[model samples]
Target: MKPLVMRIVFWSVLVAALAILAGVVYEQYGRYRAARDFPAPGKMVDIGGGRRIQLDCRGAGSPTVVFEDGLSIDGSLSWAAVQPAVAQRTRACSYSRAGLMWSDASNAPRSAKQVAQDLREALMRAGERGPFVLVGQSLGGLYATTFTRYFGSEVAGLVLVDPSHPDQVARVAAFMTETRSLRSRIAVSLAWTGLLRAAAPSLLPQAPNQTEHDAQAVRAFAPKSMVTQMAEGDATDAVLAEAGAFRDLGSRPLVVLTAMAPYTGSELRGMQITPEQGVQVQAIWEKMHEEMAAWSSRSAHRLLPKAGHDIQFDDPRAVVEAVLSVVEAVRAEGGTPPG
Candidate 1:
């Protein structure tokens, strides 16, 4: 029995050492590979010294529609289903924020306010003649509103897909502070390390129809695997950023899309969120809708019955319609949406 116990302990130490060595090598290789093959947002102009912000211009006409992706590594591909349909009637585009796929990692700042400013500069540099109808998903919603407020005159209308809510941030923070889960903490650490690694890679422009490609680009920079803690940290930070952006918005024509379903992806399931949590999130969204309703007289809310946080991917047609309506409203007002 004593000999067996000792052997077990020796093997455990060996496994631990192997893990550490593997992690160090992977990190070094990842950083090096990322720097060499970082996706570039081609023909996309940089603003504020980072290529993370990119513009993909398509079609032409009136009330140009601009789409901004949510947090994580999302890009214009999130609008894959919606942009083309909208482009048929008016000028439309979807952009990758800095540190996201096809966009250069940013070193300046990651605040919503800073991101909005970058969008402003990108538009000017790209020569995108706007009365842009700004559309955003999740954290992108925060940036969209910030842009509208800073460049109020340039904005024609707004569409927010599962837009981040400030109150939601408080709730998330409270939960994280109270929860003492080791799994959650480890997950967060892994996620941050991956994000940091992506920071070193250069940004590039991608194909308009290359949704899968875009996903692959962003995935390449993520850690070998995800853990629960990493997800919690990411979610918490997102909510906090949304809260900050919410405080700065002004009255604007806006349409917000809220999700009705809980996400059931492999990642989400791995996190062990239960059906009860789904119901709770729906309830939270209801309250969030009420809070957002007070933002403007024209502000309205829509429910995406099938989607979770990533509403666009779940139901692109609905997002397109909501965005188109905003574009029309801006055009009707004889104004261009903010680019």
Candidate 2:
């Protein structure tokens, strides 16, 4: 009886191990196929140190409009809903940051300053000249702020879509009994082991097209992608601290879009925050967004009534219009490219 029981236990363990190995192999094969079938639609430019970043540019005219992605999101896909429309009006470009999507992974520190510098190098190498109208969403907003601070002359306009404020982490953490940092750590760990990839849906329901679906799959499971994201998350405080030292935009053309809808009680509960705490979160987010708008004397602050944090996905038309307004403002001020 004991021998029979031991045999059963050993067989069960062997089956489970084989299943996990099969899942890992399947996911790896899927990643390889996705990369081959849906190659980058734009040029891969060497930023420096033999590392390459993907940059996709469309249309023509300048000051060029550059789109930057939110944290961990694909730079090119995040702007899908708005970029094509903006490109019709002016030269528009979106790029993958180091270690995201089609870009090569980097060992550099993942702070806003470092990211902004990388972008500057990529733009120069790609010959995407600017007096750029820089558009950023979420954490990309921090990079935009840093870029404007260091390369103010190169940026002709700025549009921030439901932007993340430098003080967001500390302020929001103060209100929550538990933060999402631990969850993020676990998720990244699972990604590294390919467990998340094995479980994640092959196609994102929210993905509007095949290109975006492939991009989402790559981002969802890539260990290097998660490492870059974790690095940025860990450096948020330091990035925000440095952001505080930069001077305001003064009279730069700026537009700040603020999302007003708070998470529902159930949604807050799912995140382990009480409904009351969720209210506080929304209030603080709005307050911080208002402060961001105040950075530029010429800025316009628009409250998006029903939009969530990813306003580009929720209400892309709003983002498109905001960017066009900035482009028109720059062109009106004779910030066009030289003939």
Candidate 3:
């Protein structure tokens, strides 16, 4: 009886090993196929050290609208809703930081300063010169601000969407560590194993047309990108602090868009946020947004009543109009046109 049980256990272990191996190989093959099918849409611009960052620019005119995505989100993909529309009015460029879909991974730790430098170099190399109207969402706001600080003369306008406050980590460290940071780290780790592939829905679900839908075929499960995203998430404290240093935007046409909608029941539960905590979070977020608006003397704080955190996807028209308004305002000023 003992020998029989031992043989059974050995076989069980062997079978499990085979299954995991098969899953890994299968997922890798799928990734190779996806890459072949959906190559990066834009040019891969070299940003020093022979490392490349993807820059997808559309339409024409000035000042050029440059997009920076949230920390964990796809840089160009997340701007699906608003880019094309804004492109129609003036040139719009969506750029992926190092280690995103088409961008090369960076050996150095992720920081707002590095992102700002990388973008500045890439734009100059790509000949996508300023004056740029920078549009940043979530953590991208930090990168955008850092860029403006380093090259304020080149920036014509700014739009921050539900931006991350420098003090946000300090304000809700416990909540972020307990809920978002842990969950995100785990999810990103699982992505490499193809575990999150099943849950990888359309990067932009509210995509109006099939073209936009098909364009978002890239997956977020690449090992390099996953590591990069986790690194950025981990370094939020430093990034936010770096962004906080440059508060004064002078007279740039700044528009701060805040998502004021209540979190859905599922979202609340997912974040493990209690009703009281939810209220507190909203108040803190709005207060921080107001303070960010005050950074620019010519800034306006616009509240989105129905939009959620991803205002671009939730209210594309609103985002488009906001971007166009800023672009038109800058152009009206007769700023130096892109060379």
Residue ranges of candidate 2 with Cα displaced over 4 Å: 1-20, 181-184, 202-224, 265-267, 336-339
Residue-level lDDT for 205 in candidate 3: 42
- Misplaced by over 4 Å in model 1 are 1-42, 48-52, 171-212, 221-251, 262-274, 336-339
Cα lDDT for residue 83, model 3?
88
lDDT minimum window of 10 residues, candidate 2: 201-210
Question: How accurate locally is residue 120 in candidate 2, as Cα lDDT from 0 to 100?
Answer: 91
Taking the tens digit of each residue's C-alpha lDDT, what string does model 2 give over 40-67? 7689998879899989999999879999
The lDDT, on a scale of 0 to 1, for candidate 1 is 0.66
> 81-132, model 3: which lDDT tens digit per residue?
7888998988899987888777888888678888898888888998988889
Winner on TM-score between 1 and 3 is 3
Q: What is the C-alpha lDDT of each candidate?
A: 0.66, 0.79, 0.79
How do all models score by TM-score?
A: 0.72, 0.87, 0.89
Candidate 2 vs candidate 3: which has greater TM-score?
3
| True lDDT of residue 188, candidate 1 | 41
